[model samples]
Target chain A: MDQDQKKETAIGSLFAQWTKSQADLWEDMIRMQFGMSDASEKSRKNPLHQTQKAYESGSKILGALISTLSEPENLESALKGMDSLPEFMMHITQQAYEGYLEFQKKIVEIAAKIGQHTEAYKFEGIDQNIFKVWRDIYEKEFRQYLNVPQLGLNRFHQERIARLIDTLNIFQASLNEFIYMFYIPIEKSGAVMQEKIEQLAEKGEIHDNFKEYYNMWIKTLEGHYMTLLKSPEYAEVMNNTINALVQYREAKQEVLYDILKEFPIPTNKDMDELYNDLYILKKKVSDLSRKLEESRGV
Target chain B: MSQTNIAVNLILKKLAETTGKAKIKVRKASEVLLSPLDTELSKTPYEVVYKEDRVGLKYYKPSEVKHKYPLLIVYALINRETMLDLQPGRSVVQTFLDSGLEVYMVDWGYPTRKDKYVTIDDHVNGYMDNIVDFIRKKHGLPQINLMGICMGGAFCVMYSALHPEKIKNLVTTVTPTNFDTDKGLLHVWMKYTDAFLMGESYGNMPGDLMNLGFLLLNPARLILDKYVGFFENMDDKDFVENFIRMEKWIFDSPDVPAATFHQFVTDCYRKNLLIQNKLELNGRRVDLKNITMPLLNFYGQYDHLVPPEACELLTKAVGSKDTEDICLKTGHIGIYVSSKCQREFGPKIIKWLKEREGEPKTDKSPETSRTPSGSKIRRETVKYVSPKKIIGKESKPASPDLKKAK
Candidate 1:
């Protein structure tokens, strides 16, 4: 295989593995939140048995999608297969809105239950007229405010969250298509491959193609590897990717911090922290593999 | 400067020579027909009629007057007062004279850097006081019949209010009283205007700049259309002269004394304190309600500069039970020189005054008494008759631009 194809295969495999690891960690947290585990025999007859069963099924589906990104050929095929994802996401977003309406109905039911159990006592501001006004306002408009119309981001706080997650899946599928559509063709064609590699390197990113190409080229011939190394592009790609990985980690941490602040779903936080630790391990392994591939002196 | 003078002299001489060609006997016929053509061309003969130190007022004696007491014409400090007596027949002063009224006008004179310190108090209390006193002394009259134009009208109104007993009758023409109005852009813009920066930058606001601002309020007509029309009608000498004369008067602006400008803009128009009868000059409160004298208040219906809303406010503010507000179908300047004003406005003012004064021939009153601040308490009484020709020596040509743009 050509250096470019090899690099593509390497990147595709690494990205898929990282995604699968993240998915696995999330699945583990979901099981833990529901007080279930592979070792628990009572899970079979538990009252919330469906929740544990659903988590397992969802994790498996997500894992399969992530694995498809691991191989160069599979990644290319997936990009072609998901060309209409952006349009699909739009349809999915509409369905999520309907789900949110149902979720709002459930919230009203819960609010009524809470009001039945809670006692109210007020002396200073208990105007009967103001109560009517507030009741009218609540029925008319205030409930709709919880949905962020500006971002068109679907809600996910209640059972409606499943529909929102489905929309996000489509969005991510489109983003993956965007990555493959650009990265695959450039890697397949060796003409000006170094230039494309350097460009991507300047962005501090290691695309699948560059990683595979460098590994394969180093293994083939010592003289060729030395010649390629003499070109500053090789060193530049490595430096840029390292910088990108650092930036990516920092950005991910920020996103986690923001999510924690807003949602504070402890189970999700625990899963996120677990994923981060695994990501560090995965990055260390990838770096060791790259060093071993280089030192072989192809 | 000498060349400008010579050019002006040539034009005036040419105009006179042309007048001589006609059978013009009376000053009225000569001035009416000739004055219109004097400022026709850009190169026409027009000059500053008078320029002197702090004292350039053209004082008149009772012996020189055709009527009993002198007619004190108070024009706004913003413009040259000579517009009232622009030329013989077209002149308002000439009309008063023809009707047997003695005329004496106060000239504030051109203010310079040294005069920038002068205030509203100085002009109303000091300069005006001295002019009235000089007339009273020269003619031995206790008070004079006072008529103020525009800002000069406001000054005269205040003067009459402080010393109502001295003014036999008061006539204010196109005088702004209620400055709070949307009819004129100037009043509204002035509420937030910073004259301090303007004065600091330009020393004194240039007359052209002030004029331009006024013209801009209606640019399509005042600034552009009028000038274009003037150029188009240049072939007609009469049209050309009137155009240049009007341009001259409009552009001949006096640098307003800084202090006076500050007070006028801040205290009067911006605050609308004058009409409220809450304004004070020096230490004395100017209460418009103090004016109980017979008043003839005139306004121009088409005066965009001073809307009737502003000019008519005087009727409501005054203490005079006999206040008459006449709305003329004319613009600001037309109220003074329009044919309508000549035939009706002038006659009406004289009749009103005559009625209030009780027919000058029937009643003989004593010298006007003075108030605490030396302001005359009542109109002075005297009897002086007209001669066929008590010729006023021709005034030197007022600078071509006496009425600066604003």
Candidate 2:
């Protein structure tokens, strides 16, 4: 490659690397924030009280799953040793609740930013004589809040969470009953049967009957989940999330440009005049853009 | 340059003569033509001061309309019903009131989310029922003289037919009934529309949308040429005022309830249910044969929205032997507000009603003699077509057999 081409390739690689690192950083941040580093800390309740109960329940199930994964051979041993349904239920509910809690935090953060910034920026050329256009948008969003069964989440989000919780609860109860009636009795009598059950648990695959019940619960939950995902509320959140990421990248790029473009930070007096002139320039440019658009029937 | 140009200029010259007479006549009648007492518009006759869902009627009773029997003006729901009583010298309400007729107009109010569920049945059966009941209670009368314009005329026809005993005499101007005619673009569009989807997507079909559809029907005239001509003559105050008033009325539209919109486009327009006598209002069959009262059906020879062919069917629909179809040489709105209408058409309505009611001694004997013929009414098959078709579209299908024809 020529010198210029080589430099371009290097810059492109650096950008790709930076983006990959950013994604990793986010995942790391989430894990640390949730205290997933250690077993004891992983099971602890989140301090965000609204999500605390849900988080605690989810983390506990996640803790059990992690324990099983670390020592797969012992899962068979554990299953054989297991006596009651309550323990299984406790784990399932915990994991489901934690996933929902994570979803909640992400949703609220995005929704709040959209709610604030949408007001800060006005649409460029709507006729002001048409009264209550802005007010109607505000009213619809306000009504959205009321329509939600719970505050902070959209209607579809709340419905999905409810379905998840419901399915987990039923699965937990039913599985416990199944284990108590069948598995415990077999495990108590024969070492060979206990070993077989332990082997199944270690593989992370239970008997066909257990799998059927679990799959049914998942299927029900998924039906509600897919519906929620397809909803306008979910689309808004997903769009806003992507937009936030893009805007953050743009702001970062602007910071780099500012560092490159300027000699140094300007004095306060200079900054005042600079901002004023910038604003005037922005207004003039906006007017010019509008005139162009109007001419083109845009 | 064009045939229309020569005809319009000649009409305008005749309009100027009528204007001169009107100015002189209005000056002499100013004292007697003062605003009506104890009416909502007494303070400001032009503005909408009162609106009510509770009372189930929007009474645009201009202080100017002061005849003996209050003229109940019904306008098409597709447009605001305010054109008849708009303002000052150009108003139909003012002309009627000046001629001594009390005016009560119906305003189909703006529909909201709650009103989105409203159907043709709710409007025709419920609200109309309440309005008639209220009027009856207020006036202590068994029947009221009714005037329906455009779709409102169609609604009045439905109401009158369903409850003939309640309508003393029926007057429908520019009302369309026979939709089978492929004469108007609007009829063609309505015939082919997917009303179900339109109703489902937009809970209330917007009047603005409907207006846009209408404006598209004759884009060269309505959208471009008319506006260009209007701007050219913008300096003339009288022309501008009348133009503005007409524009205001044309643009001011109410969103129709989804169910009503669906039924109107599908049942009436698409299926041609009303004219076929298969239309049902609130589970009750609407048979035009039930209408036996005095009927005066009028249509403009030049109305594009409701072609003359579309509107002339009313005279034959009713079992009323006393029906009169008055075909005028004007468009839809012109039949009410034009200077020609005042001098030529408005007087016709007053004269007909007076004859029907036997109010004038000279016309009383003829009307009295005609009362016996009403008893000879028969419920039978009849071919009904608006006189608009016979005069204009020569290729239109033969009129069905009249009850008396057989």
Candidate 3:
């Protein structure tokens, strides 16, 4: 969507929210006029003593909404919170790709700046792939850093977790693509609504009935999401994304268990094994007990 | 100047009016925020009949038992059975009891690391069978009414097929039976998923992760619009409380047992083996032809998770002569919670069950107290799939050598 259009949608949504309060007020008036509502029942449902609890809950919901609705730099940034979950997945995609692009830009700018003072470089073995060398060095350093005891993971298990995280990054990246695909409708409707809002704003048009357009925008987004949800590709992507995440988790845990094996601690693996044995034994005992009781005519 | 002046006046007036309303809203919302919020869910009372590791059987003793066979509500391992009795008036369990039916539900509690190896056989053949036997012994009946929802519905279909004699009548709401159809995204996705890798990763399917997957399925509405709407409607104590309750349920998903998840995705979703008579539990095959009891299959017309294509084929696939189906004009979850659906869902289900149970149709009034809006339901089609023809289909495939000789 165009910048103006995006702004319109954001403003329109705010106005729309305000419009809902008006509607609620209208309802309250209608109820008062009719004297149809039961104050006793309402109070019974929301006793005076419950005001504090309601405030806390309402504040929580409001706080969450305020945070979520805060204007983002772009649609993608809006969706991607600062250093959120997708980042901690150990593999980076959005940030990494953007980071690489920015890095290239910075390097070129630095080179250009340096050229003004002196020759940019000696161009010694310039024919070699420089990118690979840098990438390899970075990986090796990152791996080493991961092995540091202070890094949270033991030295032996860091490599394994690193590998898992990297593998998981590929899966998460693909999953992210699918998730972003699911957002296309939201973006589309938002754009359309934004465009209309912008046009109206430019024309200084009086949108007396903003509620209808607001509802349309929500419904349009919902309809699009629902439609996209049924697509075979969406399902495939959604399914594989989870599997990928699970694979990474399993690898990480396996590494954890391996490291835990040398120590005197009780590991997840040991617990799982014990649970399995106990479950099977429990079933056997239950079945035998039932059988014995049946035989004894109990 | 005239047009611009008029527009400016209108805009100013509207802005002032909106600001005043906004103040009221903040005040009302603050009042609600400060007030005690009872966002309680699953308020219906029930006692534990049996417990097995992460699984338990809950019995909601009826005020007066009117049915010969007790009803067993089997829920999917992924979500809690609390959804059936989500709220007072909206609860399926409540509706059943109010209609004078014995209600019992299987609660597949949160699975731990130890539960990673529990397979489909352990669930349907082992636990479900044992539960059925226990209920039968308690009630002193030969059979019971079996109902399932979503994955639980699939389990019911499998259980009914494997042990037709144990179920007097079957009710499946939004159950995905025929997985081969490209009706839903879950089917398509599961086809390519590495079930073994998933099972190996976490002992049980992480409930939170599964919940995340569900959120991703409808990101636009679920992640954004829904949350915004909740805040917008925060002034309404009822709406806010209900929203919180729903949030609690949506997030209360249980991590599925690894073995069960593995088999479900691979055997059912990937291979579409159950409908094809190729699915095996423990050592025996789950033949859909064996589900010969009276069946009432419910499906939402617009259920994205389990579409009509996923549910409608069960009658054709099964060997039930007295099968009925109700396709409600709602989504998967709406049938249980939507105000429009509350009237049709519980009432229709109860009415159908009552008719099959030899009770008069007019025993209870229709649940049409509220003006029925935003909903439509297709009448049940009692289709017949002769058991002999369906079940008697030879299990043996044609021999290669014999074919060559011929």
Model 3: per-residue Cα lDDT over A1-24, one tens digit each:
999999978875775566456555
Ranking by lDDT: 3, 1, 2
- Highest-scoring model, lDDT: 3
Model 2 TM-score relative to the real fold: 0.47
Each model's lDDT comes to 0.57, 0.56, 0.69
Whichever of 2 and 3 has more lDDT, that candidate is: 3
What is the C-alpha lDDT profile of model 2 across A195-272, one tens digit per residue? 445665566544434334333333333233323323343333333333333333333433444454566755333544
True contacts kept of each: 0.00, 0.00, 0.49
lDDT of 1 by residue, A30-146 (tens): 767876344467666765776677887887788777766665677778788797797777665665565556556655654665423211111122122322333334334333433
What is model 2's C-alpha RMSD? 30.2
CAPRI tier for the interface of model 3: incorrect
Off by over 4 Å in 1: A1-298, B1-37, B40-55, B59-66, B360-406
Tens digit per residue, CA lDDT, model 2, B161-258:
88888888888888988877766656765664443444434446767767766654433334444554454444444445445555666677777777
TM, every model: 0.45, 0.47, 0.68
Backbone clashes, each candidate: 43, 18, 13
Candidate 2 global CA lDDT score: 0.56
Q: Could you give candidate 1's per-residue lDDT for residues B1-406 as a string of tens digits?
A: 1111123455466667756743443344345446535542222112332323353455433233445656677888776776765554556665665566666777777775555556787677666665676667767877778888988898898888777766767899889878888665456556544543353233344455566555534433343335545544454555556656766676677777766777888888888888998889877999998998777788866565687898876876788766666766555776665554667666666665666665554345324453333232332122322211100000001212111223
